[model samples]
Target: MTVADAAPMPAGPGEPGFAEAVHVFNSLAVPEPAAATTARTVEQVRSAIHHAARRGLAVRVHSTGHGAAAARPVRGALLIRTALDGAVEIDPRARVARVPAGTRWESVVRAAEPHGLTAAHGSSGTVGVVGYALAGGLSPYGRMVGLAANTVRAVDLVTADGRHRRVDAESDPELFWALRGGGGGFGVVTAIEFDLFPATTVITGAAYWPGALADRLLAAWLDWARDAPVIATTSVRVMNLPDFPDVPRELAGRTTFAVDGVVHADDPVSARRCADDLLGPLRAIGAPLLDSWQPDRPSAVLLAHMDPADPLPILGDHLLLDDLDAGGAARFLDVLGEGSGSPLVGAGLRQLGGAYATPSAPGGALDRLAAAYSYAGSGLAADPDAAAALRAHCATVRTALAPWDTGRVVPSFVEDFEQPQGHLDAERAAAVERVRAGVDPDGLFRQDASPTTTRQEKVP
Candidate 1:
């Protein structure tokens, strides 16, 4: 029977009964799941997809819903909550982590800390391990390690066919490459095994400068970051802070400049030297609000970005540029730094070179792009304009940096696109189509009652 002709299925807990549905996270688009089912194991996850596909329902996966934009959840869909399945295993001998779909980066850090190991994950340890890795994850050691997807050893996924399969370089190579940067559209990734590093302490943290130095400081940051050593990674942030006693006294309710720093190496000594080179020029710009660049445990990974500990809906977007020279720096500061652009909670640019480009394996998604990745984000708010402003600012930065543009958009931050094509490759897009076809050939996975289009009809 056609998806349109298929009958409605039963709903699961917290979901509206088998009718029009919407996906909800802290913010962004909320679409419905394929159907309703409680899943805790790979078999169960597989069964749920089978049943939902039969009933003309769609399925979407969630891991803490960290990077989700308003557009993620599809209506009449099955929501797969990976966090509830929670399992994390670290293999010291192999320096690899066998983690479940629901696991968070923070869990991996804690598990590896006692063993003197660390995963080359992003600044937010609160993010889902699978979701982050799928996005060609950038790292503090990014210049040295490449994107997080580069370190992936294997993946356990429930494909479009309702079959549970393990994919690596040698097995299902095309699907494997798509998964690293293309994201969950291809299938429900239930578990992932990837490489980890040996380290107990890292020299990490950020420093805040007032907006007065926006011009000079940012120019200097761009220069230093380009030549940043393999051990270190940095980004610059410009925003106005709200006055909260909990917020650092110097930064509360004021225009500010921040240079986020990271040093993921064996000891604090080497880490510090790398961090100092990135920060030296900033000292000449403005008085710093906080300079907590010192040796700290891996568990304190959150300090690197100072991303909110509290869960709030977020809208994020990124760009990969060839360089952020003086003119490019001015445009960024003008659009997002001092007062030219709308209110944005956070905005920064990271230098991407070193190990990030030369992974032990080819960088599946990120390698397709040029070099130099820039990131921008904002807290969740009801106003769609906030999302628009964040996107507009990124566009300005992209245009200004077009001279050095390599044309790559990581999936994690590319959700808001009307049609997400530029951010992904044909093979990756084909993989998502294949997974959708194999798993939900009847078209139930689109969430819309219609389910007739190749691109699932999104429930607004």
Candidate 2:
């Protein structure tokens, strides 16, 4: 649809939903920033960036806040809230999509599903497409296709100098390379263009067992996952779901372990075969209380993980791990499984490798995740006491897994802006820094954002 067809949204602070707009999806309830502006069009974004630069004030850019820091990251600078006015446009012939920065993955999936095409979207449909794609997106198909940054074609941004430029490989080679994985150092991105794949469906879903069986199920899954095809991706999660009307009756207020996976293949028959092979071992541990694995649309994969639709008071931590042997898997389970009394709401291990371990041509600042798996855990922290306990427990979990730690961070998994991390090596990071200095000479963007910061975790 065209801009004329879309409804007009609020363009500034004090308008309806302005106060609610400052709240992120994580439900951190941070204090409002010093200055805030809403943008419904690209011109508005350009104006905000330009004005902030001249005023000598810092600027912070955000859309959905799905990956935003748990603490307040938007400070004294102007906060550019982009719910840009437009619909996603797809070109079936070219297998490309032009996504508005403020839009979510659900909108893009709906627009592309009819044509049997899909972008490399992250697991949550509610996540902002631009934020995920720009920060080196890790999708359900990451093993087969690689990070979403590998598919970027172009980006339209407003620089610190207030220049509006459409950059691609041929238009501006250096800027294009930096913007793909360099995060927000360059400028406020208004929109992006990316490649779409041919497959439209996936054989995917999740299977669950009681927490008592978490250890055995984890052991079986680790063995099976080792030989699983690159066309398949999976993760194992140990959860303590809350008792809420919205939650499934079987899962609510119960401790459970689940193995979720997806298989992307050319035909339904082949897809089912691959899924069966992946699920065979886990079934031996016990009959799962719930099993949703089956053939369906690619969008269905997003629902498999069962991430909360609304924001909650949450804090999280994650680490990358090298490939492990049978003994290593046992040690992992011993730390967080049965009788451990871990306070974490959910602790998960996502399988990684295949194409994700290999860099694609013209790779951006971050080309590959050097580890074979990712370990992530989080807890609800609604008050000071709960917050301190959650923070301390997260450290304990990390200490238990330090032996296999890769000592590197995954950009998309890191929501803590102050967390120490190294997403790239010294050489590539230096290159990205050079580009930032070139375009933003006055250091105006520095006041706005510093993705290069390796700030240590705060003592909350």
Candidate 3:
């Protein structure tokens, strides 16, 4: 169909429904697009793209807006919020799922759990499936399953030319590769299909202890993380929680140390053994203030990280790092641990190794992470002053950990648009840019390209 044939117009700023069309999860970094619309169907998405092309407007796309903070600014651009209409369709026999663009991780887990299967979903259920998977998802099961993007089998998107295309390994291998972790900007993804893994139950949850023992606990956790079994993936964090209604009384208004993750195995006995091997030593150091680790359905993995559900102001930073020695660990604690007076609500390192370090066969432009850990720290940005404090603390943490920093990032873990981010090397970035040029020669979606993917200067 011709671009002129697609008839739809988006709402401009201050127009009716514009606010809803541009809703975002991170209140701190709300976008102000020149025009915006929510697309509930592939036809609607095509219409929006055609409208933007006709108007000479650059295009930006988002689903749930969970990554709004990291997304390039949408000023003077047409923003298409994909709320594609569909349910999560699962093929139990094939262990695959066809997830619509706006669908969240919870729905996939709910749909697949009945069949004893689950996608490599992130810690929070609210995170949109397409964005997370396409941006190199670091899941609770990352050590076992690898980057979630590697599991993608197909993608359905509306290119800048207003043509709806389904690209996959068999049909368009290069486009498929670029779509999976190649850093976006190819088109507006309408839906995605990816492989799922068999999992009935998993040992997952968090354990918190008084921050006074953070040093010893961190030491023990690091010792255990080295050569940890592939079946387990975990993270250690130092949290300074506010006294909110949802926060547990014991945890509220305190600086606490925590360790949480998932242990998946073929049998319950093996899962328990792995969980014990991880939690036993930490627990022995001192009595935990609270411990919720136990065997549960795969769905429980989503809640283990305790990510807030409601929209809120947030500012943060992230890094991929080499293995930490005692000095590195001490530096981490000095900035984010007890008595650091850090304004960040939470800061920590996610263990990375096992399958995460191994490149997938037929993987995308961005596949494996060579680092040993993923470090992230974030705080609530309630106002200009609070935001400044958070940014300052983020810089402090960054400086403290610079020695071990790999100077790379997992796109999904990146928290700020200004954060240094480069998941692909020069060769891969050049190749991704070539694919983008082929699909969007007019640069209609140029602003949608990640800073690391396109040669064009990004909008600050």
lDDT of all predictions: 0.65, 0.77, 0.89
Model 3 residue 89 CA deviation (Å) reads: 0.1
How would you encode candidate 1's per-residue C-alpha lDDT over 103-220 as one tens digit per residue? 8788888888888888878787777788788776777667767778888989998776777889988987766765677544666778899999877777777888888878888778
Give one digit per residue, the lDDT tens place, for model 3 in 1-460: 5553443568888997688889989988789999999888888898888788888899999988888999888899999999887899999999999989999999999999999999999999999999999999998998988999999999999998888899998999989988888889999999999999999989999999999999999999999999899889999999999999999999999999999999996687878888888888999999999999988999999989999999999899999999999999999999998899999999999999988988456588777988999999999999899999999999999999999988778888778988787788777877888888898888888889776632233322
The 10-residue segment with the lowest total lDDT in model 3 = 451-460
Q: Rank the candidates by lDDT, best first.
A: 3, 2, 1
lDDT, model 3, position 162: 82
What is the RMSD of candidate 3? 2.6
Candidate numbers sorted by TM-score from highest down: 3, 2, 1
Clashes of 2: 0
Maximum-TM-score candidate: 3
Error of 2 at 198 (Å): 1.3
lDDT of 2 by residue, 1-460 (tens): 4554332332345666556546578776443566676677767777777677677677777788776663335656677777877789999999999987889988888789899988788878899998888778888888888888888899998888778799999999888888888756678888999999877778889988899988778777777777777788889988877787987888888888988878896677777777877787678778888999988887898898887778887787888888767767777766667667766778889998887888556567766788989888877887888878877877777777778888777677874555555566656777777888898887666644334333332112
Return the clash pairs for model 2, or none. none
Compare the candidates by lDDT and give the number of the best one: 3
